[model samples]
Target: MHRFANPGRFLRLAGAVLPWLWATALAVTAWGTAWALLYAPADWQQGETVRIMYVHVPMAWLAMGGYLGLGILSVMSLIWRHPLADLAARELAPVGAAVTALCLATGSLWGKPMWGTWWVWDARLTSVLVLFFLWLGHAALVRAFDETERGARAGAILALVGLVNLPVVKFSVDWWNTLHQPASVTRLDAPGMHVDMLYPLLVCAIGFSLLFGAIVLARTRSAVMERRIRALEMARARRADRPLAAAPATLAGD
Candidate 1:
């Protein structure tokens, strides 16, 4: 892990893995989408609207998972001064935020049909909403400082602090009376969902995870390249600023 902190090594590893990641992500996502949309049976009660679960659940899972990863990376960056960890955390923010937004949007879409409302202030929903804000806040804070190092440090601190919300998001439904359903797929007992619906959901979740990995690797590679280019440019500018050594002095009228 520490050895990979070098940008060049990280880039090489990222390049090697990215193509396979992308291919797997695309293939599985396509297959999962087809299976869920075409093959999975409608819910006995909710009917076709249950199909949205394919997208909604995966996005929600990733939203939280992505943030948790970012927070862990933030800790690494702050504690060990891992070179690429901050960059990786920075790259992950927008993707996580987008997924969180999708989760909220899909949840609203599902809620409108079943709950007869587009929004709710239930504990689970509200906590997830807070998670979204935390993503946005971290992104903004990373850019707030004039110095890049300062910004990264500040963003890392914010990420660690924001981690308090993750538990709240996870346990809110269990702790409070909410419209949101309790844990079905991750329960202690057998999953509540039937195998027909469960299999495709698992496929979609794996695909989404792959997709997230591919995107983060690509983005981190780009960031490493950008930093390298900036360093080279600054070096060139410093060279240009240095005065040339005075021309060899010849003895007067040798």
Candidate 2:
């Protein structure tokens, strides 16, 4: 892990893994989408409306999971001072935010028919909304300062503070009287969702997770390359300025 910490080494590793990640993400997501929409049996109660779970559930999972990853990155940045963690977190924010937004949108769509409303202030929904806002806040805060280091530090602090919301989001359905259903796939004894729908939903989740990883990894690679290019350009400019600065001294010596 220490050896791989070098930017050059990480870039090489990402270069190799990216091609496979991209291929697998595309293939799996496409298959999962098809399976969910075209083959999976519709719900007994909600019928076609239940199909939204294929996307919604996975988005929910990713939103929470990705924030956990962000929290880890924040720790790395603030504690260990991991060189790449800040950049990785920066790259991860928009994607995480997008997935959370999708989760909210799909949940609303699913709720419309069942609850007869497009929006509600239920505990589960409200916590997830806060999660969404936290993601947005981190993203915007990280770019707010001219100095990237300052921005990263601020973002890291914010992420750590926002970590408190995760537990609230997870347990809201259980702890409160919410319209949202209790744990289905993650129940202690057994999942409440039928096996028929469960399998396809799991596939969609895996695909989304893979796609999320691929996107973040690709973005981090680009950021590293751009930073390297800027360093080289600055070095070149400094070298070019040296001769101009020395010209008067050279003339006086002559």
Candidate 3:
């Protein structure tokens, strides 16, 4: 981890891994989509509409997973003062927000038919909505201050504060009365679904996870380079602004 904390080392490692990550993400997602849409049978109740779960579930999982990732990165940045960690956190916010939006949109599309409404204010739904707002707020706060460090500190605090709701979102159906369904795919004992459906679901989940990893890696690399360029430009500007001292006698003569 310390080795990766060094920008030079991280850049080297990223350069080596980027190609494979992109390739694997593309291949896995293609197979996963084919398996989920073509091979998996329609649900008895929801019929073909249940097929939406393949995309919806993975997006929901990634939305939560992305926020958790940001929280961890925020902690690392605040405690260790790792610039790279801050950069990673900043870079990941938009991606997480996008995933969260996808989850909500797809959930609505799936709900209109079954739930008889485009939206609901159930515990799980409300909590996840709050999560999405938190992501947007944190991203905004990160850029609000003129000082970058100040902005990062504010963002970190907000991230940690919002994290308190994650567990509640995870167990909302069990902890309180809610319209949202309880854990179906992941249970204390075993998953609820049969292998016929579970395998493709898992494949889609893996593909989504891989896609997230690749995107984050690429975004983080861009952030690092942008920071480096900013630093260099600032240094050059400062040097240009400084007045030249009187040269040494020999140099002045030359």
Cα lDDT tens digits, model 2, 205-247, are 9999999999999999999999899999999999999999999
lDDT by residue for model 3 over 1-254, one digit each (tens)? 87788998998899899999999998999999999999999988889998889999999999898999999999998899888888888889989988888999999999999999999999899988999999899889999999988889899999999999899789899999877778889898999888899999999999999999999999999889888999999999888766444345547789
In model 2, which range of ten residues has the least summed lDDT? 1-10
Scored by Cα lDDT, where does model 3 land? 0.90
Candidate 3 Cα errors over 4 Å, as ranges: 243-254
Q: lDDT, candidate 1, residue 217?
A: 88
Best by lDDT: 2
Which TM-score value belongs to model 1?
0.95
Model 1, residue 206: what's the lDDT? 94
Q: lDDT per model, in order?
A: 0.91, 0.94, 0.90
For residues 159-195, write the lDDT of model 1, one tens digit per residue. Answer: 9998999888998988889999988999988999999
What is the alpha-carbon lDDT of model 1 when measured against the actual structure? Answer: 0.91
Q: Which pairs, if any, clash in model 1?
A: none
RMSD to the true structure for each prediction, in A, is 2.5, 1.0, 2.6
